[model samples]
Target chain A: MTTPLYKKTAREIRDAVRSGAVTATAVTEAHLARIAEVDPKVDAFTQIWTDEALAQAAAVDAKVKQGVDPGPMAGVPVGVKELICTRTGKTTCASKILENFRSPYDATIIKKLDAAGAIFLGKVNMDEFAMGSSTERSTLKTTKNPWNLKCVPGGSSGGSAAAISADECAMAIGSDTGGSIRQPAALCGCVGIKPTYGRVSRYGLVAFASSLDQIGPLTKNVEDAALSLNTLCGRDPLDATSADLPVPDFTKALTGDVKGLRVGLPKEYFTEALNAEMREKVEAAVDVFRRGGAEIVPVSLPHTDYAIATYYIICTAEASANLARFDGVRYGYRHPGAKTVEEMYVLSKSEAFGPEVRRRIMLGTYVLSSGYYDAYYLKAQKVRRLIKKDFDDAFEQCDFVMGPTSPIPSFEFGAKTENPLEMYLADIYTISVNLATLPGISIPCGLTASGLPAGLQMIGRPFGEETLLRAAHCYEQTSGITLGEPPIA
Target chain B: MSKITKQDVEYVAGLAQLRLDDAAKERLVREMGDILAYMDQLNELDTSNVEPMMHAMEMTNVFRQDVVEPSLPREEALMNAPVHDGEYFIVPRILEGDAS
Candidate 1:
């Protein structure tokens, strides 16, 4: 049987649309129909941009008819995470505070995707302010794993990953701070990349933690990720932190051969803490690299143990400072019937923010507040430097680091919600990559005996996405472990 | 490791501009204390010699030519405000009381 149009990769859809073999409207309609069919079960989307998407897809069809280039991502259906600002709809960040808020302008990546001929599939749900490890924290809706309805599609990009896994869209844009992108991608059996800090512009991305947050794509395969990166990456004057470096054609790095490459195996990542089956799957992936003409180098990141602590302190501190702009007087949901502005500020924020967000803000406030600042924030920053140095040393001995993305596969909802620290530990293996400001990708390594997908994470040096992509693409193509469609698809 | 008291949660909530009820304040004291205790593990490392890395990557002040550039117009800037008078944002009350 031929693959359904909804199941085709972004590249196939783009080529077909550009060649007029398929109308962009039909493609959009097919995916929109697919979304209508499945999203009720998955609850992945916060809002579906039906009218706007059809209108945009029609424009792509018109371009094809007029003999104009339909751009690189022609007719590709993309689900944007709610945190990304779009002029067409609300940028909710999965929180009630921004429930009614509409961005006056599109984010840099939004404009880039639109210009590249991609159709918006609307904003998907996320953990409030991208704070939680599961989408259960989302105020908008609960998103379930497409692989198993009971299990959580790992989050703060849960909706993004779930939509891709369930074939609701060709690709979903997600942000990673403490593995929001890579972790969810891993759990959902998709390819998710957290590019090197500043690899992509964060101008229109609502900040979770300014220093650690990054925008990336969650797609079915590495090629799609590389294509998305080609369009997404570039320095923007609007984001001062954007890297002023050339974004090499990432697709070129998909050199099917990983011969002579050095892959680092960190001893700390493989421990009693990691589920045995997950470790075996990761080891098998490493063996693939070894047999495929790549050398495995054992390395140590001693500061790995401190990654979670350091991340929490720094991220919360940054989040508190960044989210300070949401005063009641300005845009977004404000508390009405306030006798005074101070009361309004407090009531507006407290009333709208969910539990996890308030917890983070409280923790952030405590750490950044006067007396405790030097002990917590300063100490965490110093440890963060050590984490970076660990990666620096590891890269000297190897091209990149490889391990299981999450210590365990996707878990059932409410499993870790009771203990916040436990949920934070779900990102143990992926957090250090963010702390070091390196590029990381999570590809479907293999599945467990029960058929849950396990992700193999690859961590590379600063701006080393090309190498990460090459090795990932090599493993993804050569390894026989294909991620056949999730049952929901 | 230090213990987090109810007063600390209350005080921090105030600083964060969040109004928490008594039950939330009680719950947070215990939760935040547990979290802070775990975070105390960072002190085991001797970071005395390490210069704090405020950002993951090297940062520099980015400058553009001092010239006129397009920016958000007034109406668009106030577009999402909860309460607006078209020309200005309307707020409850600022500065105690200025007899209007």
Candidate 2:
């Protein structure tokens, strides 16, 4: 009953590859074969870089043969969410605008992964411009939840999360602006981390909301998340927002000792909005920490009600400004036969962007408009400060805050498509972390009654990922709930 | 709560440089109204004295060495352009009567 090569964590695969138990090419082949077998039903990947992956894996194998250290993540096959730029492949962000677009540069994380000897399996699908809560907003294709093919993989990192759950790759990279990374990972039964805002560089990650977005890893376990975070972190000169701080090896945090750790349970998060079954499971999962000698205290984030409103206003405002760079002038999709420059800009964006993107853009443009700035945009920013202070106040009494990642488990495709606000509410628990600029991790605690996965979210202070990973690892060790295999095979 | 009308959608769409047809415009009007109504709850919180927090990190004046670095070459930069001349990006005429 050993785990399959494709199902093993990145650390396991990397160790096996470096130890000569398996060749890097063999590891890549296992994942490529798994993707070929499972990805058709899941539709997690937008492109599969067979040749490039094979070549990179072969290079790692060569380094190993020469008795040289092939790096920490040698031969680990990884999925890059399409929103993160990869120089060789298309970085479409699952939108028609960048459908044929190839990035001229690699994102800082991509470069770091390559240097660490991880093989790029190709670009995974995402929401169009990473704007929606569900992958249904992707103009490229709808990525299905591997747990239940009919349900939507919670998104805009749906494809990345699905890729890991479907065992198409050892691990994947995803960006969380709000809950894109953690929500999908929670739904797909994997570990997702949204590091403290500046912990990972955002150099070439396509900005959905500049202030909220952070690049993180989706993995089979917390150790692999810690391992991947080790490679992805560290400041980059190219990004001014990147934290100029020392990155300790995150794997060392997995001591599996939660003896004196104080975990906070936000009362607002466990309200009636959370599905009863989900709340029960999350509480049961938190009990694991309590039983493991960690103290659980109920804390209040009074501004919890304002998080969705503040996040929507601020994120959309930032998104509108960031996305304005994609006009017909420089690159990406261009509408042909425009009578004027204005016509070209309008037609190109209107035709290429999906409905969610367009709606956000319009909402953003309105909020930042002349008369509405003080009322909406500025007000949201002020509220954002209050929201951050709520977390600051809570952390004074507790070490890490805990809750269910989403109020509801995975929903049917198109269920929330008609109502964008309903979809936005799905991120109720996770959005506040981004607003507060803190690190958060979602680890699969248990399955819902319907057999779908639900995750327990743990929020940490800024650069407090080490403590979060330590606590999550301690729970993963004690909970005795192995990640369920998707019913695809 | 402010109602997002068809005229408001059209006006905002103009500002965002997006062209929406009648069906899309109507959908946006409803969706935007619903979203705005939800967001209007922010008015309930008293944020009068709070200063705006624009970025998560409190970074100020991150300076770098004033030096030239390798950049995307012109050919690679223009590779994805739909309409590009040999040297410059070609665009439709902007002026009403004059060709530049």
Candidate 3:
């Protein structure tokens, strides 16, 4: 069966627009119509830029009329995560602190998407300051999983992934601090790629954890993820951490051949903690590679159990420092008529921050405090080094490591909310990738008995996105699991 | 690990410039203890000789030429300020209590 226009892949939209089979205006309108039809059920968007999107789409059509090459992603409608700054509207990061704040400049990735002729649909919701795993932490709105409206789209990129799954937008950009991108994509039955740290510029991505945050794409398929990465990767003088290495045309990496590719199965990831159904799906995904003439080797990342603890320390510490810039003096929310500066700072933060964000900030402050600094923050940093080394050692015996993207499939909203430790544990399988600074992708492997989708994750060497994309593309093609439209779709 | 006390939560909250009420403080004390106990597992790793991986990429002192580029207009920069006086953001008194 042919997919609906709203459900079409980004490449299909770009192809039709480029070949004059359809106008970019029509493509943009179809998506806007889809958003209007289904967004209330999914709650995937924080804002929908109908007028601005149509204007941008009209501009694309005008360029085509003038015989201008409108760029690789020409006429594709895309959503930018609310945390990624855009000049057009408020970038709230799903927190009340910046509810009315408008970015003065576009993020580096936003500029790149504009250059590529991608239409900015609008900002999507996320966990407040990208803190929680389940986007139940988003103060703005509750974004439900498109697959099962009662279940959560695993977050902090919950809205971004859900938008793609619900066909609200062809593709969306999401920043993964821990498993924000991959976790949500896995749960929502789509593709999400978190490129190696420094691979994509984080110039205007509102920092959650400066070290772990990398902006990437959540899309309908692996090919679209590769295409979006091609647009996003490059050096940026504005971001000192952006890599100086040359970016390869990521689309060129999708040869769909896994012959001679050595995939590693991390023994730590396939433990009893994983759900039985999800484990079976992941094993089936690996078998596809093995049957395609690729060798599967077993490897061990002994530090796997320590990943959650280490991640919480380092991520929270960095977040505390990064978010300190939000004091009332400069911009964002402020408490009116406070007697002293300290009181004003206290009141403003207390009112604007959600519970989880405040809890993390306090924890961060404690770890980085004078007496406990060495025991907590410094020790976690050293453990982070061990995590990175574990991946490095494993990579020597294999080209890429494979596992389940999340320990279990998507759970009901508020299932793990009361216990923060339990919520943090849900990120066990995905957090180590960020700690090691490696590129990782999550693709829908198969569906559970109840019809929920399960994702298989692939990890590659630092800056090894090309190899990662090649393997993902090959598996996505041969897996034969049809991309079923969600209930809302 | 010893359980974090309400006193510890209050001290950290003060340092972070956040004001938590009695209920928030009581809950945080218990939550914080559980989190810290879980985090103590890192002590099991023999990382005495390992160097901290601070930045993902091993680069330092990324310097650029000392040239000024056009910056955001003053109005645009203050656009999001809660209480701006058309030129600068207005905040509470810094030094004295009555200096408004």
Candidate 4:
């Protein structure tokens, strides 16, 4: 019997397709078979496009046989986050309100990937409207961590993390409102990048927080993340917010050398609040970077403690405004037999949205309301500016900052669900980057004593992804932490 | 410190247009209270002269071209709507004297 091919990276599969060792159709069938075998247990995909993916792969194979050159990512299996629009597939954002909705056009990022000849595996599950820190808020199905089924993979990109961890797809694209991408990737023992705000187009990503939203890549290694970002990052006419800077060759920058790079260790990040195991693992990873010809220095972000509260207020305010369009009249579920439009609008949202989403909406409306705008929303925005200044000052002395992605590794599924404050605190270390619009990447550093994975985050200046990718690739090469796979049930 | 009361929660919910049930209101009251208390940490930081920033970097006057561009077809734009009436979206009557 031929061996199944779920464990190969996108680059490896691309090589096989290029050398005629494995046809694109064969690679597509292999991933579909793997999904058929494991998706029921992992519950990663909200909608599986088996026939479409297969046909796309077959078309690539036919083109190759006819001596026509496909693009760089030809036949690579990629899972799109549920929030991204796909022309021929359903894009529900994992919410019951939009269960029947199908986008008539593809998102700009999706178009880029499609043009590169990447196979669309499916849309992965996420928190409803990308609000919560756990996938449990998804109205469709909870995506379980492939490593330990009882724990969450982290969210609102939980399904993307779970799919990459379970070998369901080679790479996935996720949107980070705060730590959505990095948190999930950390918990699931994969690599995820939250690119600089506006580095990638947000044209068709269902808006969560317009000002803070960014589309980035999640993969098994930093190199693949770099490769995916190479294809995904560029200015798009459809998205006015996209950056107009020159796109760098991310893959060529992965030289596995960080000689003389200044890596700063933030004192506020490793405070008394951090879990001991996570601290040890993150520190050890820093030691590896120090040994890799990088200079380590101590840095302080004075406004660090205010990041969580500030992020919640600003993100929720933006979310309340962004989500106001789902009024049952435009798109999403509607309540039947309502006597008035007001009642229908209220009933549809009341029934469609989950508790966390509703909570944020209420808080946002409260903050943005006439009476409290200066005290809450405006104050948060002011503090957000200071937070950016803190990073700006710190970067004057250091090239990049290193920290633990989450204070603790993946907790149990229901650990912080009851207390919304606890869930908000989980994003403390990762929120400041979004507020500052900086680039950050999370790579698996080391495993806890209990065998759970821990992630070390590297934050860089705006448009400094090349430096961050170089540093992460250097650590990854020297640390030799194998990308652990989930035990097949 | 932010003094949020049950009435405040209800008022905010009203502004958001969300009709929360009795159980949800009670739950939100307790949760929001804790959240607000934690937010008191901001009171400790001195921001007497700090300017509030709405965006991260300096980006202004980002207006697009005034030239006409192709837009989505009417049917494609309305494909995802739950209900629509020809040229406009259909909704339950919001006003007392409005005819459906």
Query: Chain B TM-score for each model?
Result: 0.88, 0.88, 0.88, 0.84
lDDT of 3 by residue, A1-489 (tens): 465678788998988888887888988998999998899999989988889999999889998999998878888999888899899988998998998889999999999998898999998989999998878998889999988888999999999999999999999999998999999999999999999999999999999899899999999998999888889999999999999999999999999889999999999998899999999999888889998889999999999999999999999999899888888777788877566778888899999999999999998999999999999999999999999999999999999999999988888888999999899999999999999989999999988887788989999999999999999999999988765767753
On the 0 to 100 scale, the lDDT of residue A311 in model 4 is 91
Query: How high a TM-score does candidate 4 get?
Result: 0.97
The residue pairs found clashing in candidate 2 are none
* Cα distance off (Å), candidate 4, residue A355: 0.4
Which 10-residue window of candidate 4 chain A scores lowest in summed lDDT?
A: A480-489
The structural similarity of chain B in model 1 to the true chain B, as TM-score, is 0.88
TM-score of 1: 0.98
Score candidate 3 by lDDT: 0.91
Candidate number with greatest DockQ? 1
Model 3 misplaced regions, further than 4 Å = A1-3, B97-100
Clashing pairs in 3: none
Q: Please tell me what DockQ candidate 2 reaches.
A: 0.83
* lDDT per residue as tens, model 2, A58-114: 899999999989999998899999998888888888888988888888998888999
Query: What's the TM-score of every candidate structure?
Result: 0.98, 0.98, 0.98, 0.97
Q: What is the interface RMSD of each candidate, in Å?
A: 0.8, 1.0, 1.0, 1.3
Q: Per-residue lDDT for B37 in model 1?
A: 95
In model 1, what are the clashing residue pairs, if there are any? none
